[model samples]
Target chain A: MSDVKTTALVWISPSTWPACVDAARERAPDDHVVLLHVGDDRIAAEAHRAYAGLLGRGHGPERDPGSRLEALSGVAGADLLEKAAHRLGRPCELLDRHGRPQEEVIRAAADADLLICARDGDPERPGPHSLGPESRFVVDHAPCPVLLVWPHRT
Target chain B: MNSLAAEIVSVGLLLGVLAFAVARPRGLPEAVAAIPAAGLVVVLGAVSPADAWEQTHTLLPVVGFLAAILVLAQLCDDDGLFDAAGDLVARFCGGRPVRLLGGVFGVAAVTTAVLSLDATVVLLTPVVFVTASRVGAHPRPHVYACTHLANSASLLLPVSNLTNLLAFTASGLTFTRFAVLMALPWLAAIAVEYVVLRRFFAADLAVGAHPPKEAEQRTVPTFTLVVLGLTLLAFAVTSLIGIEPLWAAFAGTAVLAARALRRRRTTLPALWRAASPLFCLFVLALGIVVKAVVDNGLDTGISRILPGGESLTTLLAIAAVAALLANLINNLPAILALLPVVAPAGPGPVLAALIGVNLGPNLTYVGSLATLLWRRVLHEHDSAPSLGQFTRLGLLTVPATLIASTVALWGTLQL
Candidate 1:
């Protein structure tokens, strides 16, 4: 039995991507990856995170920091991640981090052999890919070799 | 003085007046519209539309066309097409100012030439401004060059710039013929401009390098791609359909502006509100220009000042006049004010007036609307050149562009 752990962080709009994430799931150690969407310090310290913070104290998303995904982002991500895991004949678990995305993503990179990001959100998608600012940063400064997933434009 | 002399003098004086106005614009459009208004007042005053120039009546359609373009663009802006497109441009060029500047220059030149200056500016400025800020490139030079190049590049295609639009309205020029003739020199000017100016225009900071933590916190629905595709596709289709760029703009703006409207964003209506004011300004300036050209009389004075109206001497003389007028007053007004005077010089010198005036903006920022816009948005950073530095390039490039344009105009005449 192999005993290596890999973490993958995603901080992209799910609307533009559902396919690339599916591919990432098949490749991760657990047939799934630890998804961390860290946030900024201000928001991280707040009792409430996200737009809900505007609604006032004690009235925002009251979930633990390491669980649950944005309904929109989660559906897209979970569905895609599961699809890819199935393709690889592996099993995976979906996780979420609610801190600053870049910082969380960087932290994720420490444990990640591969960080998957959607390239400009191409829905049809290719294998796991990375695009945009977050993805670029991960690739350039990640702890390990970064496998950039790209959309099959052709 | 005779009515002709009076009209020419009026135009000349009006031009001098506008030169002052350029230094003090009551509004943004005022700076650009001054030349056109002065032309209208001068021309209409000198002679009746029928009596003055045979081509005057044909220009009437410009109002409908420009209005249509404005209204349509307003509606599409309502749709979010531009926002989407802008985001994509930003994302692609992201944080690199040098790439962004080059991209903007390329995009602006191509779009302005393809879609007409008025339409191109209306559509592109939002994104260009945002990207410019990220890279810390001043929006001034970008806007300025885009304006001038918008008009200048449009000359190659009758469909490209408003000047070409007006020229088309006022003359019998066709799209194909114009593009075929001016393509080479247009290519040269753009090449020179990019090479000479791109380095100086490099960004003040590394763009797109610092992705805000907001990507995860504030989910702005990944519509950047969708919106970009939709807007670009729509605009391209409209241009292809010959549906009149303005009408296409209105349709698209309607869709994009919907969200902004629903959000009660004052920004949306503010854009619409800009239309009437711009119209009024251009109308006022055009009226003044026409009055100056027709009623006050400045041509016979120009003619007397430079003899031999048809020879090579006249060609060179009018070219010099166009260049001088462009620098002294706004290029639009300079072109309009001198149009009547050059009527006797045949297509050759008439062509000279057109080309020289169009290319003359390179001489000074105030010389062209495009130049003015470029001057307005330049980012202040270590890399961005100061006005004096930019001017040094302009001094060299403007004359070179002018000389090249003169040669291009020379082709129109067998001489």
Candidate 2:
């Protein structure tokens, strides 16, 4: 496990987890993979935080709808991380950060030797070439080299 | 014209800066866009420092009133007022798309009338989309309702739109009088929009609906609602007593702010951060620029052709011209340009011009700042309405609503 010198951080969403894992393995086959799921809880949590702060309830992110997505990401991400480790025969780590996904992915990439991500889907455009704004932002701003796996053209 | 060159420079700088602010290159914030133009007017001596101070002083009450309304809206939004409204509509509609459309109109109209059109656009658009999705309805009609009603329904009250506030200030009508004169036009505009929107989206509205999941309902904030009622009542009472509406707004704001602070729901710094002083500065700066235009012969130039009469025809003509001008350069500047031109013509035409500036902006995407903001909000939700689609709807709705509402205003004057 410690023998693998390469470290890859892969951003995972529930929809994009499978493609991300595959892309991560393809980029660094012998590298230790760390799956990072960034929950989008900032907007609603800000509202809740203000509401709770006013009332002194101090409710955590769990009470918001965003946490449900975070929970799903965690469960699916861990399972995918486990499968990827088995296939690569190396130890892998699964981590979750909650906030703006792109910002979290960038911050979590501090120790990552390579950043892996799937070209996230976009509801605004219908085509094989469409890219989510977050994916574009990550590609443009990521400090480390980014490997974006495009979805298979239908 | 001792200050001809200075006035030209002032107007030129104001127009250029306003365009930049509206276009907002590099995602500049609102204050960043508005504040510098204000500073330039003073620095250029186009507006004397003493006059700038006087102009800003006049705008203070309006700013305070608007800020308080904004705080109230934000607090209501935080307490899930909009989300709960959406959920109630979804649950109560029994998954019927048409009923849901009615619900959307109702919620958007009330939100616009009470909290301002900005609130309707910013807070209610996404909730409408989510509710439509949950019920398996086509979201287009419901989504369009948010923008259409935001403009048309906002005609009823002085606080409904910033333009209304400006008109209110200029008309010198008490709060109750403004509401009375606008009541018929407001109904007319909303009715026209409702009929047009339903017809345009008839095909979409015919889709089968899905059973909505039971949404967790939060208790409506009865205390907040009661305070809102008292605030509105205070508007009428203060007007009767010849007090500025600002005092009433401030009273309500103080109560709400105190409650929030005591309950530890929000902080003073947060409220201060949210309240923009730049808007007051922008209004003052724009007033100075418009004064320059008025001084440099634009007023006299407009006056010669400015159909002089007290007839309904005259009122409608002024409204028609205003509507056209609003489409040309957007409503804010148009109103700033036309206000002095029409004010001397008296209150009937001024209110008609108000109708034109308020309802006419639905004619084009660039007709108002609220529309621009509405478009951006829609884009964030991944539902940008195409320009052609927006125009087509606007063409169907704007003229009909504008004419009908102007006619209603004429009727009010007759009464």
Best by DockQ: 2
lDDT of 1 by residue, B4-36 (tens): 665555555564444334433332334354555
The count of backbone overlaps in candidate 2 is 3
DockQ of each: 0.02, 0.03
User: Can you tell me the CAPRI class of model 1?
Assistant: incorrect
Clash numbers, per candidate: 97, 3
The DockQ-based CAPRI class assigned to model 2 is: incorrect
Quote the positional error of residue A138 for candidate 1 in Å: 36
lDDT of 2 by residue, B112-131 (tens): 98888767765676677667
Estimate the lDDT of model 2: 0.68
- Chain B TM-score for the candidates in order: 0.64, 0.90
Instruction: Check candidate 2 and list the clashing pairs.
Output: A53-B264, A54-B264, A54-B265
